[model samples]
Structure formats: C-alpha cells, structure tokens
Target: MSTEMISITSYCLKYDIEGSFIDSLEDGGLIEIVWVNNERFIPYSVLPQLERYIRWHYELDINPEGIETIQYLLYKIDLLKQEAADLRSRLKVYEGTK
Candidate 1:
C-alpha cells in the first residue's frame, strides 16, 4: 500500500533471482509477502535481511531450513546483545550511585 514496498516480480527481474526463492523465504517465515490488488510485494524494511538470505541461498548454497535456523540464531543474538546493553547501563547507574 505504501511507497516503501517493492514488487516481487520487479525485484526478481532486477536481481535475476527466481520467484520460488521469494516463495520459499515466505514459506520459511523468514519474511512477509504483502499482496495488494493481486500483486505481491515485499516491504523495503526487509530488503537487507532478504538480501542476506539470498546470499546465503545463492552464494553459500544454504537451504530454506538452514536459513530458518540461522535467522533464529541471529534473532537470539540480537536479543542477547540488547539484554547485555541494558544490564551494562544498569550497572553503570549503580556504579554512579556509589
């Protein structure tokens, strides 16, 4: 609906990738495909992530299941990093009180 979406067909044509790759990503829950007026699109926000997955698939020859696992691990790692940063901030506040 917004201008921030790219048509899946145009993207595939521009990048020379298979449409089924996008379908597989959607099936693996790694990304969301938005359909409007009988056309499929992907939000620009997920382009970087989608490109990473594409690389993993095309360059590294990773499968959809493997991509799913990697995505899960990356998510966990981000959460842990955020948690660690919060803990550090609290620790700094406590240190300043002493």
Candidate 2:
C-alpha cells in the first residue's frame, strides 16, 4: 500500500481552515496528526473524512462535539448497512438450499 501524507500547513492553506481548528480535531480524538521530519502531516487516507469535517465546521457551523456525534452516527449507519448486506447474503444462501 502506498502511504501518502499531506502537510497540515498546506492542507490548512488550501482548505482555508485555521490550524487551531485542526488541532482541536486532534485534541478531540476526531482526527490524527502524524509528525514526520518535524512536520505535521495527515494521512491521505483520511482526506474524505477531513473534507466532511471541514464542511461540517465551515458550512454547517458544527462544533467539535457535534462533529463527534455525527461521526459516531455515521459509523453506526455503516455498521448497520454491512449487517443488512450480510443478512441478505445469508438469506440467499438459505433460499438456495431450500
């Protein structure tokens, strides 16, 4: 797997977000920061989540606690979806055996 990371400074400049906001996310355990070569970086794998967080903060004016709640809800929704899919597949297998 390719491990790509983006510098926090560049991300903040590009996204027009305050560095302190990113720091808050990290402090809140919503996102992680990787320190490499004395530079702070965020994994590229989390870009999608980071973008959503940016939208929540800037466009929706969501606070850190709200963001955390949304994240938890989204995670639960994903788990439910996966469980539903697994049940459907199992049902298909049972139907075939019937």
Candidate 3:
C-alpha cells in the first residue's frame, strides 16, 4: 500500500494539537518524523496511533509517560496475540499429521 506524507504543521492544525507533543512522541520512539523539502512530515500510517494518543491526553487526561507505557503494553499484547495464533496453527498442523 502506498502511504501519504502529511506536513506536521498541517496535521497539528487539523488536529488542534501542539507540535511539541508530536516532538515528544518522536523522542519516545513511538513515531518518526520525516523531512521532505525542509518540511517535517508524518506518515499517514501513524494516524491511528496519533489519534489514540490524543484521546488519551484529552479524554483520559493521561500524560506522555503514561501514553508511552500504554503504547508499549499494547504493542506487547499484539505480539503475544500473534504468537498465540502461530502456536495454534502449528498445533493444528501437528494434529493433521496424526
């Protein structure tokens, strides 16, 4: 799939977020900023994550550290889910051979 790059300034304006908030996310290694033609951009793929962070900050009143921790835990949960699916598939394959 092709990803579109959006300017950070435009994104912050559209979302009513501060640029420094995004900068903090970048510092925490949750998302990356790309520089194209002297403009900072974020990939479209990060929209979901960005939105989640926004909700956490606004609705849940979570700080950046809490958001980062939640992000890491969610990532771990996804990894564990994938691992469980893989193990189940392997078990099914072994059963088929029996």
Candidate 4:
C-alpha cells in the first residue's frame, strides 16, 4: 500500500559498450516498470519511458521527490470505495424503513 510513483524521462541513460542509450527496440526491452496503478500492460510504445523509469527508479532505487503520491492516491481510492459501499448499505436500510 505504500508503493511509490516515479517520473524520469529527461535524464540520460547509457546502453551497450558504445555508451549511447538504446532508444529503439530489438535489444533488451527498453522499458520496465511495475506499480500498483500499472497492474496491467501499458501501451507497448510507452516501454521506453518505462525502461527509463526502471533504470532510474528500480535498479538505482532513486525515487524522485514527492513519489509518495501513489501511496496516498491508492489509500484514498480504497477509502472511497469502502465509504461508497457503506453508503449504499445505509441507503438500502433507509429505503426499507420508508
């Protein structure tokens, strides 16, 4: 529940012995990011951005500032869902009483 969200696109990355970032496919997948929100497959084209995220965040463990937003977001979503369910139950009770 305390997972983080990150954004790292502008930073540079090095790939292969040549030292240039591999901005194309055909080599290793140029993207890797796993998050609570990204539970499913995001668009394939966005992989490079995900790759940058993995390199800078996961492998390096260097999460950006304010990355705790995900945790807060998830927490609020969960709370709202529960609250909605409770309201529905109360609504049913009031309807029956009426």
Candidate 5:
C-alpha cells in the first residue's frame, strides 16, 4: 500500500489504497459536463459521483510518467478550486436566503 494522488477525471476522482480504489467524490470538475449527449442536458446534475470506496490520497514521492503526472496534478488543483467555489457559492446562497 502506498499513499499517492492521481486525478482520475476532471470532476469524478479516485483515491486508492494498495492499487484498489478506496474513495470517489464530486467537486464540480469540468469533465462533469463534457460527457453530455446534448447541449440541453443539465451539466451539474449529470456529473459523475465519486465511488464509495475512495479515501484520502496522501502526498507521496513516487514519480509517474512525466506528462501524465503533470496532467494529474493540474486536474487535482482544478478539483480543489472547484470545491472552493462550490463552498463559497453555497455559503452565499444560504446567507442571501436567510
């Protein structure tokens, strides 16, 4: 088992322990809407859900393929940014409604 991080997709992500997927989560990554069959499709609702098994991916040092590694990290940052945006939007919505 190793603690590592990799971005599975733009929206849905996977965290694994010992080569087994342990957790999956939703954070509004752009890939969420890319799979739509049509423009009329709702982007937010169609987003894939992170599977139940994924868990925290600890920072690690094992090197992956250079280009793949860069893509993975960039998407991870995107996930985090989307999460922050979602949280902030939710907070503002609740505050305004109160």
Candidate 6:
C-alpha cells in the first residue's frame, strides 16, 4: 500500500470508534479500504470524507442509511448550484451582447 495511507485499526483505536463503523462505511460505498498484507488501510485522500461521516454518525447520531441520503442530497444540491452558475454565466454573455 502507499505510505500516504493510515491503518484503519489504528484510526479506530485512537478515536475510540468501533471497527464495524468502518465496515458500515465500506458497505455504504462512502469510502474505500485498501488491503495490504491482510491489514485494512485508507488513503489520505479519503480521510476527510471518513472524518465527515464519522462526525455525522457519532456527533449527529446518523446511521449509514441516513448518511447515504445526506450524501445524495448534497450531491444533488451541488449539481443544482453548478447548473445555476452556468445559467447565470450564459445570461451574462447574452446581456453583454445587448
């Protein structure tokens, strides 16, 4: 595995979280786990996302299904924001021609 990865076990132990939470995240497709020499590790690139999910789970008391729903809604909101920005840019172009 890459040196930029953190061991999942170590992370769980440090945070006092259960390993099954990571398993739930993996099953929910929220994060990818790499197996190196029979150990599970997560790349640094995904650490932020994992932390976000952890907060939602532990702090906000959200389950995996709730997290999945929140993720989907956030994705849709981002898409809508992008679409609005694109439309505004096109409108500006039209106004500039007038």
How many collisions per candidate?
0, 0, 0, 1, 7, 0
Error of 6 at 29 (Å): 0.7
- Model 4, poorest ten-residue lDDT window? 17-26
The list of candidate 2 runs beyond 4 A from truth reads 96-98
- Clashing residue pairs, backbone N/CA/C < 3 A, model 5: 22-53, 22-54, 23-53, 23-54, 23-55, 24-50, 25-50
Model 4 residue 44 CA deviation (Å) reads 31
Ranking by TM-score: 6, 1, 2, 3, 4, 5
What is candidate 5's CA lDDT for residue 91?
Answer: 98
The better candidate by TM-score, 1 or 6, is 6
Which ranges in model 1 have alpha carbons more than 4 Å from their true place?
A: 93-98
In candidate 4, residue 62 scores what lDDT? 45
| The 10-residue segment with the lowest total lDDT in model 5 | 19-28
Clashing pairs in 3: none
Alpha-carbon lDDT, every model: 0.95, 0.91, 0.90, 0.46, 0.38, 0.93
lDDT (10s digit) by residue, model 5, range 5-60: 33334323232333222111122232232323432121433323222112123343
**Candidate 4: tens digits of C-alpha lDDT, residues 1-98:** 34333322322222221112322221344434333443422344565554554455446654433223443566799999999999999999999998
Q: Candidate 4: TM-score?
A: 0.36
Q: Can you tell me which runs of candidate 6 are displaced by over 4 Å?
A: 1-3
Tens digit per residue, CA lDDT, model 2, 1-98: 66799999999998789999898888889898999899999998878888889999999999888999999999999999999999999999999998
State, as a TM-score between 0 and 1, how close model 3 is to the true structure: 0.78
- lDDT, candidate 2, equals 0.91
Q: Is candidate 4 or candidate 6 better by TM-score?
A: 6
lDDT of 6 by residue, 4-50 (tens): 89899899989999899999989989899999999999898999999
What shift in Å separates residue 86 of candidate 2 from its native position after superposition?
A: 1.9
Residue-wise C-alpha lDDT for candidate 3, range 11-66, written one tens digit per residue = 99998999998998889888888888899999988888888888898899888888
Task: Using TM-score, give the best candidate's number.
Answer: 6
lDDT ranking, high to low: 1, 6, 2, 3, 4, 5
After aligning candidate 2 to the native by TM-score, how far in Å is the CA of 46 from where it should be?
Answer: 1.9
Off by over 4 Å in 5: 1-64
Query: Whole-model lDDT for model 3 versus the true structure?
Result: 0.90
